[model samples]
Structure formats: C-alpha cells, structure tokens
Target: MSMKRPNVFRGYAALICAALLAPGSPAAAFDAPARIEQNLSLNAQCGLRAFVHNLNGGLASARVIPLVSGSSAQTQAAGGASYFNGATSNIFSAVTAANLQANCGLADVTNLVQQGAAGAYAAAASISLTFEATRTSNGDRYAYRAEISGAAATTVTVSQTLVNAAPTVTLGPPSGPNSSGDYTVVATLSENSSDFTAASLTLTNATATMSGSGSSYTIVLTPVTDGAVNASVQKGAFTDSGGLGNWFASNTLSFSNTVEKTQKVIAQFMQTRANQLISSQPDLTGFLSGSDTGALNMTVTEGGGAFGFASAPDKGNGVWARLSGSWSHESDRKTSYAFGVIGSHVNLSPDLLVGGMIEFDFLGQKEGATRVDGNGWLIGPYFVARSPAHPLFFEGRFLYGQTKNDISPLGTYSDSFETQRLLTQFKVTGEIAQGRTTWMPSLQLSYTTDTQRAYTDGLGNFIPEQGFELTQAELGLDVRHEVLLPRSRGRLELTGGLSFVGSSAKGSGYASLVVPEYAGGRGKVKAGANYTLPNGAVLVMDVYNDGIGAAGYESYGAQFGFNLMF
Candidate 1:
C-alpha cells in the first residue's frame, strides 16, 4: 500500500511538470528581453557612423573605419590625395553591435560626460555631443583633421528616460535639454574600441587619464591637469581594448564643466581674562567695606562636546564670605555649575555668620578651535544671618537667589541676556578679623515679587520696569583675617556688590533706574583680590564704586564687601 501511495504522488508531480513545460504555459510564455549592443563615433571632417549587434548570436566584424561622406571622399581624392599610405594600412579589432552594448553595461555615466577628461585630442561623448578624429598616413607623416558635432549640446536633460541603467546615446528631445541640473546616460562600445592613452580633452587647454571598472570602459572627462577649467562644460574620452583615440572638443570656446559647491562644518569654544589683557597695573588696590560679599571669577571654555553635572543652584539671594575649603567643577574647564556650604564667627557686634549657595549657568560654549561659543544662564540660592547689636557695627539676615544669562552664536552679530533674580539680600554678623574686629557692616536690598524672572525683551538695551527692583543700599569697609597669623591663610580681602531698585526713571511710566550716577551707573568701577594660606584656605576682598555717594552726587568710594565668590 505504501509503495502504491508513492507511485500516486510521483504521477501527480509529473503532471505538474508537463503543464509548466508546455509551450503556452505561464512559465514557458515569459521570455527574456532581447539584448542589443551599440557603438558610435564621429569625426570633424568625416560624417558619423554607428555599429549595432545582438548578444544572443550574431556575426560581425569589429574594425575601426575612418567614416567619410561620399562628397568628402571624392573632393579629397580630386584634391591631390594619393594612395601612398596603403602599405602601412593595419586593421585593428573586430567590433560588432553586441560588443557596443556590452561595453556600456548597466551603469550611470552622467559624471563622465559632464566632467570630461582633460586634454585637446581625447574624444568625448555624452547623450548629446560627439567628437572623433581619424589620421591617415601621408608619405612619412599622418594627418587627420578633427570633426565635432552636437545636437543641442548647449543644455543637459534630466528625467526617468534620460537616466538609463545602461550606456546610451541620443539626440536632444523635441523641446531641447534643460540648461541646468545633473543628468546621466550609459554608453556601450565595442571591446575593440580605440585606445585612450594618447587621447586629450583639450590640446592646449586641458588633459585627462582613462579610468573605469571593466576591460571595456566608460570615459570620465575632467578639466586640464594642474590647470583650472571653466565650471560650465563637459570634456574627456573612453579608450577601448584597442588603441584608437576618441576626442572631446569645444565649438564656442565658452564650454565648461560643473562641480558641486564645497561645504564645511564648525565646532569651537573660547575664554579670556579680559582685565589682564586690558590693564597695565599689576596690583589691585581699593578700600574694604560692608561685609565681604565674595570674589568674581572668569573661566575659559572648550567646544563641540557634551557636559554633564550633579545638582545645581536654585534662584534666591543673600551674600556670605569665602570659606577655607571650596571646590568647583567645569565642562571643558568652564564653571557650568557649582555648590558648597560654609560658616564663620567674627568679633563684631553682629558676630556669627553662616550660609551656602548653589549656582547654575547656561552660557553656551565659547568660540575658538578649542573653545565653545554661545549664551548661557545661571541660578542659585543662598542664606546669610548676622547679630543685631551695633548700628555702626551691627547684624543682618537674608537668603536665596538665581542668575540669568545670554550670549551670541559663532561668528554672528546676534546677542541675548536674561536676569535670574529680582531681589537681593545679605544678613551676616561676625567679628572683624585682626585688629579691625568688633565691627561689622550689613547691606541689604530685597525684592518681594517675581524674584528671579528673566528680562525677555530689549536685551542689551536696559529697561527698568521690566527689570528686578532693589530695596536697600548699604556701604561699609573693614579689615579682616589679621588674626590668622602672618596673613598666611591667604590675604584678607574686602568685597562689595550693589543692588538697583526698579522705579520709573526720567519721569516716564517705564519702571527703570537709567541713571549711571547711582549704583546702577553704566561706568561705575569695581575691583577685588585674594591671597592663599598654607592651610589651603583663601581670603578674598572686593569693592564696588556704586556711582552714588554721600555728597548727593557721583560718590566713588567702596560700597559692598564679600569674602567668598560672586
């Protein structure tokens, strides 16, 4: 029974095969496309001729012939042309139509024609232009004039029809070709086509070399070697296995080859010590005042890389002095964000002082080969409290803060800025360091509404109503750090910062204090310095000339003070 079952399956399989093999069966009905090959050549004096053959099976001779017109042959023969070169006549390669199609293959040839090879004698062709020359021996010398012809060669045509997977030649469309955009074509030549070694795109203007994938090849035309070519035309030639020359020539002398524009990318960062670069003075000097606020620092940056960090500062305000130990981190060496805490005890009426701050900034990197460039933002919160016994030597209390920022892009004139805090306050009570102890200064400027919002409009142009308001102004300068022994724990420093109140200025409804004569003045000068101690602790000092003085005019003495960073 099993044997019988196997026989039945075999019979069914044979029936299916018979149906598929039948002449009219679907499988049998599909036929492969007919394969055809073509080769073409033209001469200046000689007309034009093309060879074609079928790849399936065809008999044809692939011989190079100097195409000639009946009229030209008769005219030349009558013009003293002799048969003296008959002895040197040599036949090269057997070429057929099939050979032509095979050479072109199924590939793109747009760049070849448009960027034709350099040199004067090299024959070049695209779908539009054709050039060739044939030399015949005349006694001891051979001479063959050039022939160049093109049908609407002034333009390039692009479309699905023009983009052939195989090389081809065609005249312009009925409407002519497009004067712009890139196009492609395929060309097939006999395996025995001429050699390109001696071929040239421009005799005196350009030169070229032969290159491609197959033994039979496609020609690429470029401008002259070590010379510039007009960026508007195509030139070059394709050499076959045989040593015959194909040439590309220009009829109007205005032809040129096209090249795509060049493009480059930019990535960088930058930072500089502006004061050091501009000032000639080696030492910073000024009176010390108020409580030490802190130090102002500048950092350099590097660009084109990512920066990551831990926690950042919240938006709030109050000032404190620098501590013995403070550490910071940076992305590409620029302080992207920072955090720390510290407290100190002074002998002044408002004695004990303590607080901490966390800061965040978004200054896009600086600009340079190694620098990052752009705008940035910074925000941090802080707290400070001091005793309240002395009026001339008293105490203060305050906290919280935030900072806003902006910058320009690489090489452009665009710029931006933002404010992160609306109110500022400082409250710290501690004994003055050294013999200057027993006295402390408190400066407080506080705001209640929209504390750390950024100024959105009129960036760079100051507008008061849109800015944060200041509540108070205090000025004080005193020496500290003398008790630390030989001033080693870094030099004692006096630091100060100002707070401007937002109010309608110039009697205008705009709430802004536009007067530079006040602490908000455009030209107020501020300065500070620091010294390092053997214990690695640092003492900092600062002074700000808030442009407002006790004389009811432009007061220029030190105003605020700080022992830490600003």
Candidate 2:
C-alpha cells in the first residue's frame, strides 16, 4: 500500500464494519456495498474468524434474497403487479412483518427472516394478504394490514340521522264532488309536506288507491263506506328531501260520513227521552215529568178504569203550563176525581228542577154502612237537584191541603168536619249503574199532620166536638232495577220497597168517625212490568201489598198510555 491508515483510524473502521455486520440492521445492509466498492471491504483482511463471520453473514443475506426474487417473479407473472403494484407494496411489506412476528420463534431470529420471506412471496403471488400484529413490552411491535389486487378493497360506512322532532299530520275533510261511492281523502303534513309523496297511508274498512301527492296527499277511496274509516301511516313511510331523515308514524285518524240533520235530531231526542217502559208508577214527585205537550192515560184498578189527561203547553222561554185531571173508582163503590195545574220552567238550570201544583180532589164513598163525601184542595211545591259529578239526587216536597167532609152515621151520629193537612217529604236516590241495565236505590222520609174541626150540617155552624188530630212519620227504602230486552227493544223494570210507619191519633171523635186504625209499623212490597210498542204506546201491570200488623191493603192494577212528542 502505499499509504497505511493510522492505527486509530483503522480501529474505527473495524468497529464500523462490526456494527454493519450485526444482525437485524437494514440500514447497514443497504450501505455495506458502498464500502466494498471503495476497496475497503472488511472480508479482504479478516482471518479465519472473520471468514466464519462472513459465512454467517452470507447465509443471513441469502435468507431474504430468495424472498425478493420470488416476489419479483410473482409480480411479473401477475401482469406487472397490476393488483399489488408499487403503490400497494408498502401494504404487502407491513403484512409480511406482521406474519413474521406471529409465526417466528423467539429462540431463532432466522425463523422470522424465513417467515417474512414467505409472507412477502405469498402476498405477491395471491395479490391479497391480511394480518394483525400487536406490540409487546419487550420491544416487539405488531401491526395489521391487508392488500387486495385485481379487486380493490372497498370500505362502506353507513349512518343514520334522526329527525329533529316528530312531525304532525292532520287529516283534511274528505274531498268530494258529493258522490255516494267515490271520494278522496286528503292529509296535510305540518312539516316537510312534500315528504308524504312516498308515504304509505292505510285505510281500514275501505280500499285506498293513491291518486296524487304534494304538500298534501290525495288518496281515492272506492265504495265510500259507513261507520269509521281508520287511517294510519307506516313507520319510515316518508323520507325528507335529502333522503337522510324520515317522518314519524303519524297518529291514527278517523272520519265519519255526514248524517242528515233531521235524523240526528231525532236520534238525540230518542236518546234523551226517558224509558217509560221501565217505570211502574206515575211521576208522583213530578221529577220525571215528560216534555210532551199533551198526554192521556187510562189505568184499570181492581174495580174500574181511571182516566187522566195532562197538558204541558210551552209558554215560550223555557216556561210551560202544566194542567192535569184524573178520575178513579174502586170496587167498593168509592169514587175520586182530581184536577191540577202548575207552571214549570226547566231551563232554569241543568241540575235543578222546580215546580208547583195546585190541585182539587173529590171523594165519595157509598158502601156498606158508611156514606162519606169529601172535597179537598191541595197546594204542593217540589224541587229536585242532582249533583252533576255524582250519581246522587235529592228531592224535597211540601203539601198543604184543606178538606170538607160530611159523614153520615158516624158511629151513631152524623157529622160534618173540615180537615187541614200538612205533609213534608224528602227523597234521596243514587244510581249504581248508568246504562240499559241500571240499578237505583232510594230512601224517603215523610211527616204528616192532620187536624179536623166539627161543623153542623143544617145551620152550617161550627161545633166544638173535640175533633181528632193525627200525626204520622214514615221512612222507606226502595230498590229499582231496569233491564233492556234485546229482541223487543223494550225494558223490564223490577222494584221492591219496605216502609215503617208510626202514627198517633187524639180525641174521642176518631173512634166515632171510624177512622182507619193507626198502626205502629208497616211493610210494603210491589212488583210491576211494562212493555212498550214501537209506536210509543205502553202497557203496564202491577201488584202491591201494604201490611200493618194483621190489617193490610192489596191491589192489582194495569195501565195503558201513549207518549206524544212534538
């Protein structure tokens, strides 16, 4: 040589070469040839030990050479690597690294080299490879990559956007040229109305065919049906303009066909009208009085038929004039007649009803040893109030009457007397059920006081004969049930009652007048049935028993009447 490097320089050179020859040094492998071309090759001067090292190095170098060669060959065979070309080579390299890390043994680094070579070769040949690698705390790194050629790997991402709020759907009136069999239904959307174009609108009890669409949709329904037409929309039936969001399932809607005004009025009237077939007694309290302008009723008792007529003429402004007359006869040769008139105003309030009655009655008895004739005039005022929110009802009444009686053969004496009577009653009733099958329970309390004054018949002069006075108090409980008949569209009514009566009579005249025995207690029971014809005529039959100790009163009766509506 001509020029020998310094000892220190030689030492540094040797150290650099040793570093370059170390295993897993990719940078040194790339730079080692430059040093050899400069004639500074360490192999030239190294001895046997160096020779052994070189041999190892050559083996190591040969390890990856076949992989590179195979990769090139596969790339060339696959039409110049059209699938995994240079652009995708990095993906293949990453997959190779991952495969090496997964399959290599820790004791043998050469195994990793071999595995890397095989993975690279496979990636190039198949044009596709996928691998995952994880890094460990020991400085081992793992990664994942996939290479696909001929068919590129495509990644698709799907997302959903929610609506800001639920949309409101309103149903417009039916679109019609007023035909019986054909009509169109219209629906308008509060927001994004145009979205309804693709909405699926379903109609129940009818067929819907889409006719047109816009902010509002028009659907043609054929054979326009009655009853209820239920319409609903399906979930996701409509998408916004951008196809991103959808409308909420709208609330169900319904439409009914138009009904004639007259029919509606008649139906309402019928519904409001009382079911007279269910009532066995007359409106004694006037609470159940009808609005009919005029009505005539005939009832047959155990003996004779009683005739009654009532008229309620409208006096304008919710006021009505009520006038009624009645006549009755009993099998025991007893006769009675009554005439009454009152004014009623119903529109005063919905929950309260008020009325007054002024009545005059005549009674004549000509049977056995008793001959009695009497005429009486009574004035009564009554009121009923019902709590709108409850099933409770309350009624109160006050009655005052004056009668003139002429009794012949009163024991052994004939007498004429004037009688004054005062009566007060209160009733409370409650409904247990509301419909065709209804149950009502009622409680009633009554107090009565009667005083009589004696008079002389011929001279019409007052006589102080110690006339009798009577006072009575009674309490009663009544239970009533009404059931509607399915076939006849009629109603069956059942009623039962129990009453306790207490009375006291004073004065010696009571025995002389042969007054009825005043009992300390009483019991009453009743049963009745009525049937109504389609023409609003009614037929009723009833029986009742009133018992006081061993003495009692019983009767069977029937009535026929028609309700008139104007």
Candidate 3:
C-alpha cells in the first residue's frame, strides 16, 4: 500500500526519496524491513536537523517573517505555514531588526515560532514534535530538539552558541539656562536603559552627579564657568542586563549658560515764534485779516540789552513770508546774532486749517576770546481747528532741524547737531460788541532738545559735552477794545495781556557752562495798540516785560510795526 503525501510534506518527502534512490551502498544492501526502518530513522533525523538549522539561522540573523493578511489556502500555498502565521516571506522587507527589537516583544516571536512548527507538521498521522531555542543571555548557547511518536519513537537534539546583540541608546531633552541667566542642567536617557548606571555618565566643562538606577538615570551638571556646558555618556562604561558589554554607545548633549547686555541715550533743541500775522492780528468779530487782501508789516523789539527786526508779508490766499534778524548781548559780554527767512502757506477750510513752514537761520556768538558759529534749517507742519459753533480753537506744530557748529578755538573739534521742537496751544475767545471788544484766553506748551557734540576749550582741547533739553509753558489772557473813528472810517485797537510763564532746562556735561539753567515760574505783561489809518493801513506797537523773580534773567522788550494793506 502507498500513502499520499500532503503538499506541506511534499518538499521533505522528495528530499528523502532522492537520498534513498541515490547510488548509496548502505540502503542498497538492506532488506524490505531494514529499508523501512532505515527510511523512518532517516526521515526523522533529516526533518529535525532542518528545523533546528532554520530556527537558529532566523534567530541569529534577526530576520522578520513577512506575515501578510490572506486566506488560509493562500497562506498555506505560499509556504507561510513553515515559519509565521500566514507569512508569505521569511525575509525582512518592511521592518529592520532594530525596529522589531524595539517594537515587537519577545513573546510575539515565541508565539510565531510555535505556530509555524504546528503548521509545518499538521499533515503527520503520528505525533509530530518541533523545537526552537533562543538565547536568554549574551554569549549563550542555542539548544534545539525534536521528538516523533508512532510504532517507533525517535528524538533529535542539537546545540549551537551565539554572541549577544548590541544595545541601542538614545538621549532625552537637555535642561540648562535660557536667555534669562538661570543656571541649571539635567541630562537623561531617551532609550535603552536595561543596565544603565550613574557611574557611566561623564561631563566636559562641567561636573556631573547622577540620580536613579538601572535603565533610567538623571545627571545633574554644574558648569565650571558661564558658557556652553556639555555632558556625555562614557563609552565602554555601559552594559546590558544580559552582561553584554559596550552595548550603549557614548552620546553628548550641549547647552548654554550665559547672558547678554545692551545700553542707549538720546537728546534734542527747539525755538518757536507765532509771527506777526498770527500774534498781532486783532480778534474782531466779522474781521478776516488774511482774506481778499495782502499786507506788509515790520517789527522792532528791544529788551535785555538786545535789539531785533522782523518783517512779514502776506501774499493773500493764506500764504505768507518772513525775514528776521536778531542780536543779543548777555551779562557776560557774550554777543550773538541770527538771521532767517521763513516761507509759509496756510490752507483754511471750514473744519481745519493746515500749514507748513521752512526756514534757514545763521547764528554766531562770541564770548571772551572764543567764537562759535552755526547755521540751522527747520521744517515743520502745523494744524489749527475751530468748532463753527464754539469759541474754542486748537493748534499744534511739529518741527525738526539740523545745525552744524564751527568753533574757532577748537580748530577741528566741531560737529553737527540735530534738534526737534513741538508746540501745542489752545485759545478760547468771547466777543462783546459786533466788532468792538474781545477777550481771549490761551494756553501754550513748548518742548525742545539739542544733540550732544564735542566742544573745544581755549587750549584747543576737545571736551565731551553732552546735550541738553528745554521745556516751557505759558498761559495768558488778552482783552482788546476798538474805538471806531467816524471821520476816518477806520478803527483804533488797544490790546492788553497778562501771561504766566514756566520754563525748565536740563544741561549735561560742559553744557552748563555754555547754556544757562532756566527753571521756575514767571509773570509777564503786554500792552499793544493797532492804529487804523485813513488809507486802510494799520500801525501796531507792543511792549512786554517778563521773568518777574523766577528766571535766570529778567527781560523787557518793545516791538513796533506797520502793516500796509492792499
């Protein structure tokens, strides 16, 4: 009788049948009974040997069997039953050995081996046994066995030794000082901790102490200096739980522990004059000064041992021009003079008035034997607004200027300076008669700054003089009463005002020697009159005295001007 071999057993049967049919003397001399016994023993021995060889080879190479999802028939046909459950290939195609070691547990591989063995022998009538062995520790030996049961029982066992695999190690996040100057560091492991110890860690440019035991460990590092701190795991100092030396490779971590610093300083000077057009105009009801017609006016002011002249021309359509020159002599016999021309234009609408001014000024001052000369140019934009239904008016101005100073005593020790000025003012007016008497109250604020520059002394040595700032505020009230001349068909206006002025100056370095410290409260009084000519011309005269006990010096000045209207 002949028995049919299962497809799973066909490959093994073919190998044994080829061996038996080969021209071999041992099997040729055997009788029927001897041949049958010899075949059984040979089959059992060959099967056991192949099983142990494949198992040890798979484990040694860390090969991953490809277990694809499919039907049982397809899996059995693809030879998957020989190794893993429904596995189509014994080659590791998708995952690496390290990946499997990290993600797939040992229990998973053990189950796969047991399932593969059962499927490989499922067709046997008698009890078919398969064995597998793995290394439980590094440098251990592999032991494999197989047993068969039937009319005759047979057993086979084999042993082989292998070296342990290397352990993989990774690092965790490092802690240290950030940008805020805090100093602390903690280094730890990110992976593979089986046999890690505190003594296995080392540091460079820092000192380290360890905490925790076994696989996980923390190292505290104290930096010798404030800079970059580096910590690393010492090579050859780490071993796996299986006593596999040099498992965890050395790794280094770096961090910073330092701080940065930065510093800055700024300075600014400004001068503002309302001009004759805005300051001297009478606040008469139904009176428009800069409309329809133009005028030319000249002014002369003398006070504080100084004299000055100003001429302004209105070109109609809210456009104006000014030429001014001033000379001043201080108590210390310091003399200074300045000349400038200003071109300005104003746009007056129902809601707001917008205007801008550009001026170039040249000034020179001489004190004792030292002389200083400078020229400055200023550009500024201003705005004014008044509510049509109210008597309140607001005005603001912002100006920027640059000046280059030349000193005769300092030789080459002169520099350029920048300045910024700001002015804001508000006025409230109440008119009694239609165009007769008016009472106006106003408040004004001013700010100025001058940049620092190198100054020279009489010995031609440079002085590190810093910049200075000056700020002033004033509040005033003015009353104007006009007398109508029936014969001349003109008006004579008389105006009087009282103002309180407060000012402060901040000086730096040698600035105190050149610029006076002016701070405190002061009182001012002004009287002015505008005479209307029979020919529609106006004559204006004003006188003012200020700094009543609250300034560096008292000043009294008078101004006279004539306006010819066309």
Candidate 4:
C-alpha cells in the first residue's frame, strides 16, 4: 500500500504538467519575455533583439530605429562600441560607433550603416540619444535608447539594454620567480565573453597549450630558444552570447619565453643600484658651513635599508673626508650591501680648500634562486674644490670610478667583468642671518654614469653590454632657528627646507628587461635639528623625503649623528 501511494502522487503531477503545457500556456511566451519594464543588463553586446525586447515589448506599432546615412546619433551602437567610451555626452552628433559589428555583438548592424543610411532614414516618433551600453574593463562601451508604439497608439515603456564589448588582451607573467622555469603565461581579457577560448589566441615562435574561462586563460609554451614568446587574438575569434559582435584583434604581448637561458638579465638589474651609484656624497646638508672636525652617523631609509656615516674635516690642513656603509634587506629575497673608505690630500688657505680624494668601495648582491650571488669592488679618485666663506659657500667634486664584478649565477659557473663610472657634483649656498634665524638658499647639480661592458655567461648566452646614467638638479632654501639653552650655554638649531627636485634616469638600466623607469620632476622636504655644546661638539638629527632623489623609487630616511670641531 505504501508503494502504491507514491504512484498516486506521481499521477497527480502529470495532470498539472499537462494543463500548464496546453495551448496559450506555451513555455515560449514566458521564456521570450513579452515585455521588460526594468532596465535590461546582460554580459552580451547590445543588439536588435535586445532593443526590441526592451523598447517594443508587448507594443503593437514597431519603431523604426535606423542610423541614417552620414547620420551619427549619440544613442546608437556601432561596431558594438559606445559612442562616448563610457563618458556621457549631451550632443547628438558628437557620437560615432567605433567597432560596429564586434563592439555591439551584432552581425548586421545595418542600422549602424552610417554611409548606407546617410540621409536615408529618420525617427518619426520620439528618439533617445542615450540608453544602455556594453563595457570592457579597459575598452569602450556602447548603448542606445528607443520607443515602440502599438498600432492603436498603445504606449510601451522605454527601457535600456546592457551588453558586452569585445575585450582588450593583456599577456602577463605567470606566477613568480619570474625567471627560467616551467610557468604559464596568462592571457587576460578586459572583459568576460561567452565564446572567447584558448583556441581564440594565437602565439608566435612557441607552441602553447592553453586553459581557462573566456575572460582569462593560461598557456604553457614551447621554446623560442633565446627569443621571446608572443600572444594575441585575431578578429572573429568568437562571437558574443548575443550571437553578434564578433571578437576583434587583441593587443600582443612579447614575453621573455621560458627563458631557459642564463642569469645575465638578473645580474644587470642588480648592478644598477650599487651603493657607488646613488649615494653621491655624505651628509653635507647639516654642516656645510662649520668646520666640524669628525662626525659619526647612523640612519635608516625606506624599505628597511640602513647606512652609517663618518667624516673628518681638518680645517688646518683642508680636506673633504667622508665614509659611509650601506646595507639593505631582502625585497623578494634579494639583498645588497656596500662598505667604503676614503682618503684625500688637501691644501688649506684662509678661505679656500682644494683637494683630491681616493676611495675604495666593496659591494655584494644576492639575487636569491633564479640567479645565485654576486660580489664586486670599486676604486675611484675625486677632484674636489671648496670655498668655505662665512656668508657664502661653493663646492665642486668630480669622480672617476673603475669597477670589477664576479658573477656566479650557477653553482658550477662564474665570470668576471669590468666597467667604469663617472660622477660630477656641484653646490652653492648663500646665507642670510637676521636676529636668531638664518636662511640659506642653495642650488645643487649632480651627474653620474656607468659604462657598458661585455661578458660571457659561460652558458653560451652572449648579449651586448648595457650601461646606466642618472642626473639630478635641486634648488632649495634652508632656514635655521637657534635657541639659547639655559645653564649649559649651549644652542639648539632647528632647521628645515623645501626643494624642487628634477631627475635624469631616462635611459638607465636594462632596457630589454622592461624594468620600470624612474619618474621625473617632483618636490622634496627636509627637517632637522642640531645641538651644539660649549665644548665645540654637536649632536645632529635629520629626516628627508625626496622621491625625485630616488628617481621614481621611494627614498626617505632619518639619521642621527655627532660632530666635533678642533
């Protein structure tokens, strides 16, 4: 009896299904909506049916929406593209469809045939200049609005349709270690699609196996040997879900293929930021005027990189003595550090000091995994001149550097290379003293260069030598406010400055590697305070935020130091 009860229930359901499937209750009426009252949005290109369903839904009279010959209305979609590229425009003639067929996902955008329809047609009733649109993440969107009336003048509600636009392509590096290894290069679209597939993309110089959804796909490629891999999609790769807007060509991406090569590229990147490159001078900002005999400093920069400074100024003998040790922790597991020593001979006069300096610098970099480790040394001579006048000061320094490096990107392979660098720096300052405050107007210029050199990677990869160059000019004003200390007869100097910074990293570092270039023309601010004791000793603390100083890189730091005078 329990089994029979189940059969009875099933028989009752059959009766209900029969009635619903009968005559006027056909499922097509419900599936193909008779009328849509609300705004219609779909991830497909806007087209005719979308317009009919929204504007003419259940209406008797059909609206003739034709883009007249030579007539470009703001509301029409052409090539499945928006007239405004996602922007709104009030002007009617200001819009033109970009990609009529593909952008609107329409096969026959006859209505979009501007030349064919030129002066051929016009809307009899009301027309909509702006309605709905198709959009891509980085591409244009298209839309239009219209009205349809019944034969008996019955009104149909106005509505808009949203659809998909052909997407732009981007070929990006696979999951990290961005080096020689088995990894997938991904081809991503600016928007999702119904039919965009791995088969839709084309590759050059490499055979690829691809996988993923329509919006984005991943591919593994064969070899181009030492060359790069390219990826792009041609027009007509696939159609939008609307059965229109055939896909268009995509942007091509050239990739450093499964690089199976050596680590020469990595070595080039690590060589650019060597300490000898940017740390052009010591902390000259704080003690440019006074004859502070010797000083010691410790400071930390952005990215947790730190450095220490030491200087000795012999007023009686006249010499520019300075030393610095800098070190930086891992950024993506890559680390670098440098230590240097300087010695110079000088002639001292009543108001002028002329000298030449010799410096030896040792530095090393570890490129974690993709490449092994590297170390190098640099020796240089600098010609220096200075006028330490009371109200004004002028200084010039010219340096010639010779460098050699040992690179071992593999456990069993290593090579040696030599290169040279040049640096020229100049500064001038004028001081105005009034009451307890002094203002110093300063201007500085600096230029540095690294020569190109050729080397063998020992792995059969031979490439041309690349060089780097950097230039800077800064004009600023520094203000010093002195406070007389009680009982100790000591004085505290509060100092601050603002500078307009300019850069010159235009063609620096590995061009082939697509390394991001530094930025240009910005502002820098500096603030500091120093305390001078009656014993001719001073304590110094300072901070600087100089983005242009680092040339597109973040360079900000705080330092503390002590100086003694004879």
Task: Find the candidate with the highest lDDT and give its number.
Answer: 4
Clashes of 4: 27
Residue 414 lDDT in candidate 1: 36
lDDT per residue as tens, model 1, 1-566:
86899999999999999988876511111021231223233223322122112222211111223444442311111111111111111133222222222231211112211121111111122112121112221111111122222212212221112211111111111110112212221223323344323242233333433444433333333334212232211123443343332222223122222111000011011111111111111100010124233343332222212211111122242322221111223443432222233322232223332333332222333323222222322223332233244332222233343433333322333334333332234333234444533444333333322221223232233222233233334344333332343624454444333433222111111212221112332223455545554543344444556445234435343222222233
TM-score of model number 2: 0.40
* Candidate 3 regions with alpha-carbon error over 4 angstroms: 1-295, 300-319, 329-349, 409-435, 455-460, 512-518
lDDT against the true structure, per candidate, is: 0.27, 0.43, 0.46, 0.53
Compose the digit string of candidate 3's lDDT tens values, residues 1-566.
Answer: 14554765898989999998887322111111221111111111121221211121111111222233331111111112232321123442322223223332221112122222222322221222222223322222232322222223222222232334545445565653322323343444433556566566676667756666555666566667544676666645676655545534556676643211000011212222222112322221212222234455666655323223333335464455544455556664444444444445454666576667665666565554445566666677766666667666666656676666555432323334333332333343333344677877777766655654544444333445455666767788888898777766678899899988787776555344334475788898999999988898788888988778663668787888877765
For candidate 2, give the lDDT of residue 311. 56
List residue ranges in candidate 4 displaced over 4 A.
1-276, 283-290, 300-320, 339-341, 348-351, 370-390, 408-414, 508-519, 532-540, 548-566
Candidate 2 vs candidate 3: the TM-score winner is 3
Quote the positional error of residue 500 for candidate 4 in Å.
2.1
Candidate 4's error at 388, in angstroms?
A: 9.8
- Specify the poorest-scoring 10-residue window by lDDT in model 3: 259-268
Full ranking by lDDT: 4, 3, 2, 1
Go through the candidates in order and give the C-alpha RMSD of each one to the true structure.
26.1, 30.5, 22.4, 24.9
Question: What's the true lDDT of residue 245 in model 1?
Answer: 26
lDDT of 2 at 375: 67
